[model samples]
Target: MKSLGSSCSSRAAAETPEASRERRAGRGALWSAWPRCAPRDLAFCMAALLLFCLGSLFIQLNGGPPKVLLELRNYLGESTYLDDHGPPAPKVLPFPSQVIYNRVGKCGSRTVVLLLRILAERHQFNLVSSDIHNKTRLTKHEQVELMRNISTIPQPFLYTRHVHFLNFTRFRIEQPVYINIIRDPINRFLSNYFFRRFGDWRGEQNHLIRTPRMKDDERYLDINVCILENYPECSNPRLFYIVPYFCGQHPQCREPGVWALERAKQNVLENFLLVGILEELEDVLLLLERLLPHYFSDVLTIYKSPAFWKVGNLTGTVKKSMPTLEALQVLYRRMKYEYEFYNFVRDQFHLVKKKIGLKSLLPISSHEPSFLRELTLHTPDPLEEEEEEVEEVEDDAKNWLVQP
Candidate 1:
């Protein structure tokens, strides 16, 4: 009986070691088959990460954020006019915005207005054309009329017109986002002079002086002669109708001097959100579209070919013979104020673009938060608070303007 008990104890002890080894082997195999993440989930995660990075990059590049924001707000993976259930978390989307476009004539206002109209249609945002019908742009008269009543505009609109900035300055919202385009002052005057004769709005103005002494196609009004003779409209286009439209609506803006020049520059920096030059319209539009895909994405479609530019290219203006140095000098003198303002506008536009960190960029997704801030994190301050802040900015700008 003693020998039998000792043999059973040795057999049980030996089996215990084998049982432990089998259990360890089974646990190792189960862990080896288990995945850190399913393939679909892993793919989704990678895609989400990629989008968030891209969205962040876009906002960072556009220095004049308003120019690109309203248009791109839809894609920032937040709640937009198109989707209340914007992309999933981590996507930082901006709130709905109001934009005002002070569309100065012959400064690519048509293209800008058209782009806004298309954006309005696609995004279902309210676009206020005011005077002009949906099909055509506003005439000069209509633009002026719109300016008189610009103050009555409701909040949250993308209002456009070929009017001066002053007209809308008092009428805008706190933290207002104003945008305008400017052309070379001299060139703009010349273009308008000729365009009036050959393009459309000919013989309708008080200044037009068509004499029997000119050739048939040379719709040279006496006003053109007066303009060449060192007059603005015939000598001061600002007093009549002109560029530097970003200057406020005050009677002084149309008067020639450093005051209007400084005011225009200040407005561009402090008030206007974006100021684009006519020569660089295409590239700027491209930049705008990339920065604000929602509003300007379709802008490039109409301007697909350079041919769109040709329709009005050098029309009614002398094409072959360049203006002589003497003529150019005389013209420059007449438009010195305009030229100065134009130069300032051009410089300011580039400066703002640089400030906004303009660059070649690609749009990204906003579904992931690790790559960017939740856009919804941004809540604009109360309207009163926002106004106070803007007032501070304006005060600072005024001080700078007054400095010697």
Candidate 2:
């Protein structure tokens, strides 16, 4: 019986070791299969993830979405569906893909357009330059048609034309980013006056070809006589040229007064991305590069290149002559609103330059009345020889007929 009891105890002890090993192995398997976590800990982790997601959504709503996210969204939005069961997905390009340059004539537009030709190829953006240069003011129907036409252009396109400001918001269409350039009002007038009569380096007969109907006397009209004697060409409304480009197609825009001036200034503030000064063209290009890098990247470099300069030199008006100081004073007094608008744009441009850490090559005095003095300094030297080109006066005969 003692031997039997001892054998049973030994057998139980040996089974106990095996049973313990099996239990330990089961516990290890359970641990490996599923991680153990306290209910509170799991809840905290879930709450933290939810909070992070909510914060990201809030940021995306308040601030604009990050560029990476925008690109991703665009990609997803543009992705093709494998199944042809549903309509194709809509594509939303990043902002400022559609740009409009309602170019004001003789404001270094030709030069900018020339540069854009090169940029369009390099950057792979569509450049739609309108051939219609003369007609700026358009009828309401014409505006709607033109707007629709412009909207149909493919994504990431820049459309340029010598047209007045068209209010896209008025037509319930998406507004495109607007850009333009303006020069000193008097300087612009002088440049146009000469350019029309002597049509750059294209040829001596370029002016006649442009304005075939222009009488020899009208074509050869003197700048001083035009301003001092109140020639219809140099008169009001006709002189009120640049403001209309910004003031939209309103009839009052053609009038030379506070209403037109104010509307133009407001448009410039609200719509235009940039309205550069022709006098500081290099600085303008720099600003354009900084502001709209996609369209104008390396534009400054291209402008400074030897090839661009060779092309630019050909476009300089052959017989540009500055008006006499008396005539300039007269012209200045006549274009009071024009100068005011010019000064306002200049101030705004300078502010932007300062914001972007660009130093102006020419220091502009703070005094408002120094425009005539500054004009004298900035105006091109009088050319001794006469060359023929079409003038705005001959084409815009009806505008001059209207009494101011």
Candidate 3:
């Protein structure tokens, strides 16, 4: 009976150790699951709420995406007057990839073409040659053929030619920007005349070497005779050149009249991105550097510095002597429209310089252009004078009504 009782006690002790191990194993699973499930879900919900709040604030401030881009104002510290809505539109624009240069004759356009070639060489843009090589206002079919070739010439190409301005859409150019230079009409016509006569009358042809079989000017033996004739084909045909070039190559614009003058001015304002004057080539260089940095990044430096401007005054093409006073008078009379167009362009350039506050173009010590400086010596435009008179009268009337 004693032996049997001792054996039962040992069996009960062995069973107690196995029951304790099972209780510890169940507690380990609950501890691991608490970290992986409930806390993670709580963190995710808080992040989502914070993102929603930030997105809502942005939408309220900017109105909407389309307007936000259009209204983006470059603040040099919160710019000019704005209504309760917001600020005015911007002026600083991104760079352009393609460009069209409508090269007017004897306007120092060759210099600009040289700059484009330099840009193409450095920046890897294509400087394409047009199929129609003639400078005279091309016939309609010739214009179409040249434009057709240009439209499909591929990206990053700069088209430089003595072509006149026409509607870009008619030629299928995508987002084209036009640029040109104009000279004093008298100077422009003279350059072309002597250039044909003496093949660079400056006695230096090294600047632009003549190719074999170059055509000589036999239009007239004497400069005076050329000017005296005032023929459309001969004697400095200024009427056929300046205004018609800007007014498009159409026949209507070719006729010397007010219609051509007005049309040319309108097209320049609407189509041309920039227009430069030949007399102020330095200003042109500075303006180009500032406005079209991507294309003319180092024009002044790489293209022979300030001295280059003086060398190309007449582009190695001024005659040893000039025409007689009477002949010149005849030339200017025929080219009255050219003179008006020249003055208009020069005035517009000055206005741009003033508005932009261009510091690099000219020095403070520099004087105004002779023409503008001596405005009192010349007759004012009748149209502008009438406008001034009307404003004066309106002011006097207002003063009379307000008198106490």
> CA lDDT of each candidate?
0.57, 0.84, 0.66
Write the residue-wise lDDT of candidate 3 on 156-239 in tens digits.
Answer: 567877777756577665646777889877667777766655556345563235433444444336777655765544543445
Candidate 2 residue pairs in clash (backbone atoms < 3 Å): 196-389, 196-390, 197-388, 197-389, 198-388, 198-389, 207-389
Better of 1 and 3 by lDDT: 3
User: Which 10 residues in a row give candidate 3 its minimum summed lDDT?
Assistant: 364-373
| Top candidate, metric lDDT | 2
Q: Which residues of candidate 1, in runs, are more than 4 Å off?
A: 1-96, 132-156, 167-175, 200-218, 221-225, 228-232, 237-244, 290-293, 305-322, 355-404
Quality of model 1 by C-alpha lDDT:
0.57
* Regions more than 4 Å wrong, model 3: 1-94, 129-135, 171-175, 201-220, 229-238, 306-315, 359-404
Error of 2 at 51 (Å): 50
- Looking at model 3, the pairs that clash are none
lDDT of 2 by residue, 200-288 (tens): 88588888788888888998999999999999889787888998999999998999999999999999999999988887899999998
Off by over 4 Å in 2: 1-92, 366-404
Q: Is candidate 1 or candidate 2 better by lDDT?
A: 2
Worst-scoring 10-residue span by lDDT in model 1: 366-375
lDDT of 2: 0.84
